[model samples]
Target: MCALKTLSLFLVLALFISPKIQTTTFQTIKPKLSILVDNSKSISYFKEEKNLQDFIYELKNNTRVSDKFEIENYIFSSDLQVSDSIDFLGSATNIYKAVTAVNKLNSEKKAPILLLTDGNQTIGNAYEFMSSEQKVYPIIFGDTTTYTDLKITQINTNKYSYLNNKFPVEVLLNYDGIGAVKKTFSIESGGKTIFSKRMQFSKKEGSRIITFDLVASKVGVNYFTGSIEKIKNEKNIKNNTRNFSVEVIDEQARVLLLTDVLHPDIGSLKKAIESNPQRAVTVSKVADFNGNFSEFELVILYQPTNVFKAVFAKIKKAQCNLFIVTGTNTDWALLNAQQLGFNKNFLQETENYGARYHSSFSTFLQKDIGFEQFPPLKDAFGILNFYREHQDIVLQEIRGVETTQPLISFLEQEKQKIAVVFGEGIWRWRAASFLRSGTFQDFDQFIGNAVQYVTAHKNKARLEVNSEHIYASNTVINIAAFFTDTNYKFDNSAALEITLTNKETKKKTTFPFSLRNNSYQIALENLSPGVYNFKVQVLGQSHSKYGSFKITKYQMEAQFTHAAAFKLKQLAVNTGGASFYSDEITRLTQDLLTDETYYSEQKAIVKEQILLEWKWLLLLIISACTAEWFLRKYYGKI
Candidate 1:
């Protein structure tokens, strides 16, 4: 009984006296190491596949390095992918993208990167200029031995040319380690050599530029191949040839200018519009207008009188683009009756109005021609009342006071584009521009861009599809679409479907567009090199659109012949690291293991607990009290 009572007293006192205690521990965190291996096609040129595999195997098996690091492996070419194996079969190399990917993946915890590559970047930005917080050690894979190689570096030419017109093609040739060698450069089209020339290089390493003029005779896509004859001991033949395509359109856009009387402005406007090679202008008097108006894409009217009302009606009915120049002879009452865009109350007086360029115009890019510097236009003083909203106001009138009254404006109404110039004597502006700058480029560009914008085709359908007309074979094709309600507001509640047909193979592919942030988009991948036609339609609606695009067979990997050692060195220097060759990879490993920055980090962890609330304390107290009660009852002392 005495022992049980004493135990109960001790248990109760221990609970009140106990305090919380804390224990601390320290652990070493292994440093993170990221290894990036180049799997691009260029790595295969130097037979470095086995060497890369051996290097990775040694690193992972080395206890000194493996014990210090938590490793991550990645293989990259044009894209970054996490993998345990490397395959040297990628079509192109994008070193910049690989570095960027590592930086993004380790944004929270910066890890040191070990890169193995030939540093031949055929796509994306240069990796040398990319900044990162982690050190990057680059191990070059290819030999630095110089060899003889003649490569066609670049071919510059227009992608589109008019039929029967001669276009210029410039070829850039690079020669390495060959001195005083005569090489033959040839251009072939339709499997026949059309032009050939012999060029002699005097230096062992240099670049030569060759220019040729070729006629675009056919009205279709013309594929041309430029080649340099292989040398006696040349091993790399892929870079010696390159292929490009030019689309030969049928004819230039024809523009007709109809006027009531001959004016100097007609000649000025014709010269400016025809400055572009893709456009031609013809001027004729309104009374003698007998040409086919249907053939012209755009029709310009200069102060037409009531006699040409039939011509105006025909133009409106045909829905051709119109550019109206209003002057003293303009019949405003008749023009207003047509409800073209605006109505004016003539005061029977004329005044000169200078032009002020509007900064808020969005229809087209405006030129920096200094509209304020140009001469004034002879316009009638009137109260103009606009009936419809204008798309953009290119030029506003500045008559002693700057006013919002538009002098030149573009409008779209009833699916037709109309541009109105409410004055005359624009010839004076062209003359002034030439007098100031000694060139008519600014003035010509201003007029030419405006004319092109108003005459360009406008899509008024509720269903509109947007895509580029040309794509490279390796690129993914993304087609975007938009749906509109009856009032031209965005409506995406309807499902849309597109059917793509390969023109040559007659194979069909159907895909449904997925809704993406108020629009619809679909991605098409691995499309072969050919022309494809697509038709899109909205389900349960009559809205449909059709178009075609072409993909070219071109690979960037075939253009590069040697590795870029200087770039790889620069990347190492920029990140406070060093460069090494493949044979010196061991030195890189030793250096990383010895570097203090890569050492493991130790952190201490502390924890605290209250002993009074422990379950063992409660059980002991219950047992002690029960034993004391039992003893007291047995001894008859309860």
Candidate 2:
């Protein structure tokens, strides 16, 4: 009876007392730490490489700092890599890549970063623009001494020149020293010193611009080397010499202009096309032309008459590019009967129409030639019907109100490029442009671009590969390809493969292109500086294409002879961190440990058993009272 009374009393007290007794726990969250190490070629200039290794080892193994953070390490040059070994063989340095890599890896859990570098960023964005959310402590390395360097800064010349023509070559020479010195600047081509000059540098640190006129004597890829005699004690000699190549082409495009009568438009067109040294223009009347039609690559017809209907047939048979200008004299009946891809319905009248530039024209870029200021062109009042579905409209009509009627348009039919101007009086455009802008450059560019686009060779292959002919060593080679069926529709159902070979090393590497948005593209990285030959082939077909490109050597690491401490310090100041030298790297450990913001954070977890949720205890109390009442009632002591 006493034990039962004791248990009943205990049950009633436990429900109220359990709510007061709660358990608390604390969880310590260690702050994350990221380490970025420079693996560029410049790091090899450090005198004591062991000191750098020891510092890295100490930072990684130090328990006081390591225990407080979850550390991750990475190495970077032009790109980021997660690795422990530092070979210092990377040819470029990009500090921005280091920060971006760390930011991507620790995006969810931000942390402080420890950057070890020489601060000599060569290729990529500036590291000062790194994300501000994470603090960065830079440990700068490399020599801070000043040294003399004389180098060729730039070479300005065209990539292609005509045969036997004199081309201008400009060389920029930069010198850094105290004393004046005499240097010999020379240019060598075809294993001979073609040009040489002696120049004196008197300024402490300045640049000299030297110009030379060299004749393109050979018809091939001419390799030219511009160099300066090396000075004593120069920090870097690799940049003292530079190599550039120019292609000398012997073939010139012949353009035959067929006109019904003498007009200023013929002279204007001739002058514009001849501005390019690679083009020659010949104007002749349709009845006076005696030359073979096959001799010309392009033909411009101005208002063709029925007298020369056979001339049009000869041009079509030769498959030459045509720029047809239509006016009141055009033989519309004969032109329409020949099925020249367009038909006209004349109203027996002429109308004046101003030009409104078309926004969707992408065949060739349009220049700002003030089309609105030019006088309107005279066109036969008509409605033109185009047979082709894909017409590139360059200009629209604004007779009184803007209409969608094409004033100037281009069409591609049966492997022939044909451009049509629905009006006449383009010569006025040139004169008006000169009056407004005081120059005919805009008018000339507008006509020149159109001629260039039409004269360019069109590729009719179902599979096409496109890539730049030249790329820098640090840049990724992105090659894109387009595949089409026999009906000229994009097809991505076939597998594409490419075999890249280094010309110097004769090494072959094969890669498969990944399909993206109905096209095939592949990105190749880490290709050494050299000429590479590539061949692309599509599976299940004999279709293939071959190409070659050059990758210039990356000398960015040699551009800087000293570490950039000011930039590193500025980055540290902006990111709320401290800057230290390599010798003071040990201080970084202590600073991070002492920093209140970098310490481990603790979160308290309190657990309480609420009286309402203690259903077993409540049941026990109810049972105890019931048992007591039952016993009292049974014993007649209620």
Candidate 3:
């Protein structure tokens, strides 16, 4: 009785303190079995939709299999989705994507996968090469039928072509029929036939590559279709034709390299600017140059001195873009007196400072190309100050101390977009970049982007968009937009929406954009095949932008006439799992039930519970008191 009273008093003390107590209990966690069903339109195209549905129904309804393992159902098309609804209407088949997704989501469970697919993956990397320990048991479907069909396996063409230039087109053709088949392969654009050739394919020689060239006379987006004449009674006619597009440009931008002296840096700058096929660089000395300064889109003054005074005057009057390079030979006094864009207060000596990246530079999105490790550039030793509020791409680091002085910077003050590199001897940087990255692409690309930004016209528009010209059917349209305030800073509070108008249906729809990662992003779905013209407009502002993209009437899932069982079998064998056909459901279930590799595991689950919040604990305390009192009364001690 005294012990019972002590227990009651302790319980009361625990309730007053209100301390949380944790207790660990063990429970059996059944090993998860992940089912990745290919809900792709290819199954429906192969006429095996019913067969796949029946197999899924039987497997899901099996009580014995469900009772043994925790089942996770997923479906895949162009991408993977966790779903119980199987409509067999997925537009693409990416088995590798499905398997990789399951591996990631169930990384802890290391769940065994049961994949159901025709094995016709139209996108993503190869599944057979995926490195994971989780076993993948692929239930192969659509292997029973083989139809006579000819397919345009692939079409290769360039994304852009110079005007009036002949662009090459290569078509890969494949025929699965038993005999030698002949078909008329043709190319069409704007509903008119452009090129035609007769191609032959046999069972032994089942594929052929036909290459031809077409003249790009027009200067705009040109759509083309490469197709083979369909054979008699062809079931998979969707794969008979392939559509592609090319953008034709009129001319390249002209850039003149005007320098007063000759240096290796001049060669490096010229080569870097010319690396982009769109920009042509012409090197000329200021004294010998007699061309029209305004003809060139940009003029690069290398190590400019008093000799470039007349050239700068002409360029300033022209209002053309300028990329100024200063070094040991630069006449800073004259350049500062001219007051083009920026001024540096340098001492008599030229100092060598290391480069430090500035992450807050938002004039453009550029990755740090490992500039901090490169050899320092030579600039006049002083407090290099800017006249305007400029953005620095790389700041100066004197010895080990990072300074506020700008090494490479950009400023627009005198109605001219100017980029200045307050240094020289960057030709050595090419070799240093190659030594670091095994290639000069990083350095060359950085230089090219700097030059491109300087030469490119200032886009004062408040709205900007980055998107593709074409998208495949059933793929999500991810349109990204950037809305800025009048001062050109990104505005997050702005209400931006996109209005898409279908060219064919004449129907318009609007969708709002969500803010993510400092940008306005929107994902659109269920858009039909047509050319969509979209306008991104700010709600309360008059600023708007327009663009168009074509959604092709193409489905990757319908490109298959039969299943690829061998690939799935190889994948299963590589992952320590067995491959079975849809008819082998019984054997698959038995293997799962009998395989000791899969079993429930006991795991300790520790849960924190409050002392006074448990109603059952209070009842137990009362029962203890009541029992103690009843015993004491029965013993005549009440």
Candidate 4:
């Protein structure tokens, strides 16, 4: 009876007490050691692949170093990657990018880095000048000794030029010989030397810059090769020659601004049309004009009077595009009689009308541009009545009351397009656009879009391809295309494909463009240096678009023959680390093992929980109480 009573009482008391527990443990944290190996093609040029692999193998296998630190392996060429690729076939070497990547790893324990490279960077900023909190120990590969070499370091030139225009080219030549020498620097085009000059270099002055201009006589794709005379027994002649390309275009459309009187509106129209590089504007008085009408794509008739009768007759005969602007000075009677798409009824009285953008206008994509806030334009109080069905882009408002009269309208009939602006003083609108947006781009784009629509070809293309004409060898080239239906609406079901052909090798490659972001696009990651022509077409359609692009011959990895020991040394010094050669792997491993600053850390973890909630303890208490109660019940007499 006493045992059973005591056991039950003990269980009740323990549950009420609800004791807590405290558990302590220790954890060992190892210092991080980041190892970056170079996989760029420059390492193969220097013949350091074997040395790099040997160093990585030994460093990872060293028992003492492994025990003291947590080692991580990384590979880098132009970018940093997690594993090792010993192929040494990367196109570029970017040491700074690799180092920056190491710094970005999420870790509380700062790690020391091991960099292996030829110390030559083809892209990114200079690595030696970069600031870092972690120490960088650089292992340089290849010959560190300086040699006598004459090289072309850099070249600067324009990628585009007009026909018969001169483009400037600048070349930077450098020498590393101890004695003074004279050599010839020449530029060649079409297998002929177009320019040559003798350059003298001394030990004190080993660099020379040559700048000159070349005439772009041919219409398309002019390539030039610049070279420096090589000294005898030069170690590497790969860098002695460099080449560049310029695309000469001659298809700029001409715009004739024909006006009877000089006004600010004429200059504004000219500036807006010329804002587009594909269009050129020439301003002239309509009475004094005597030029070939076949050369111009669009003609601006500014405030025309009786003197413009002959010009209008010529325009109608040629079926050319026209932009007519009218104001107080315009002769409405004569203009209405000429039957130029619209008729105006007005008196000599003038009035100012505010511009109101029409929401339903679909002639072209119009920018809002805060048209309601623009200064009112001056014109004779009149209403323009279009004789043909047209689009009204802007309407006129008088005394804060919107009217049905159109301000800017477009009409197309009989293969000829005519756009009329009822009011003048558009120059003020241009100034207001600048004042609001801080740039004339909005106003200029608005004007340019309208002009483009007026001058557009009758046979519009269904598939439009957009791409630059030239690209460097290192950059990623992409071409995009947009396909539209008969109503100029986007068509997404049709598949688009393109075929790229190399002009030099006569080789052709086909690539398909995937629909992305409402446009079909394709990425051409790597391409050889040459002129390439491409044809893009819809699979089920008959129309196709043709274009061409050029890739410059640039191989930054092959430009340098020796390692950049000085840059590596400076990088090590700046980061408070040490520099080592390829054969110094053993020494590096020993230093890492002996360094006391980077050591293992011990962290203690403590945990606490309610002891009463333990399942095993609760089960034991219940079994003891039940056994005691059973014995008491069996021994009872009553």
Best by lDDT: 4
* lDDT for residue 385 in candidate 4, whole number 0-100: 80
Over 4 Å off in model 4, which ranges? 1-24, 106-108, 251-495, 514-529, 541-544, 551-554, 604-638
- C-alpha RMSD of each candidate structure in angstroms: 13.3, 13.4, 8.9, 13.0
C-alpha lDDT score of every prediction, in listed order: 0.81, 0.79, 0.83, 0.84
Residue 216 displacement (Å), model 1 = 4.0
Model 3, position 444: C-alpha lDDT score: 80
Better of 2 and 4 by TM-score: 4
Instruction: Please write out the lDDT profile of model 4 over residues 44-155, one tens digit for every residue.
Output: 8888888889888888888888988888889988889998657887778889879988988924556999999889998877789887778899999988888898999988
Candidate ranking under TM-score, highest first, comes to 3, 4, 1, 2
Candidate 3 structure quality by residue, lDDT tens digits, 2-23? 8898888887776667788899
Error of 1 at 391 (Å): 14
Collision count for each candidate, in order = 0, 0, 0, 0
Cα deviation at 544, candidate 1, in Å, is 5.8
- Candidate 2 minimal-lDDT segment of 10 residues: 359-368
lDDT of 1 by residue, 277-335 (tens): 67899888888888778899899998867877889788877888888888877777778
TM-score of each: 0.59, 0.56, 0.69, 0.61
* Candidate 1 lDDT (Cα, 0 to 1): 0.81
Give lDDT tens digits, candidate 2, residues 48-159: 3566677799888899888889888888887899887888777778887678778777776759989888898876667775566788999988777766778888788866
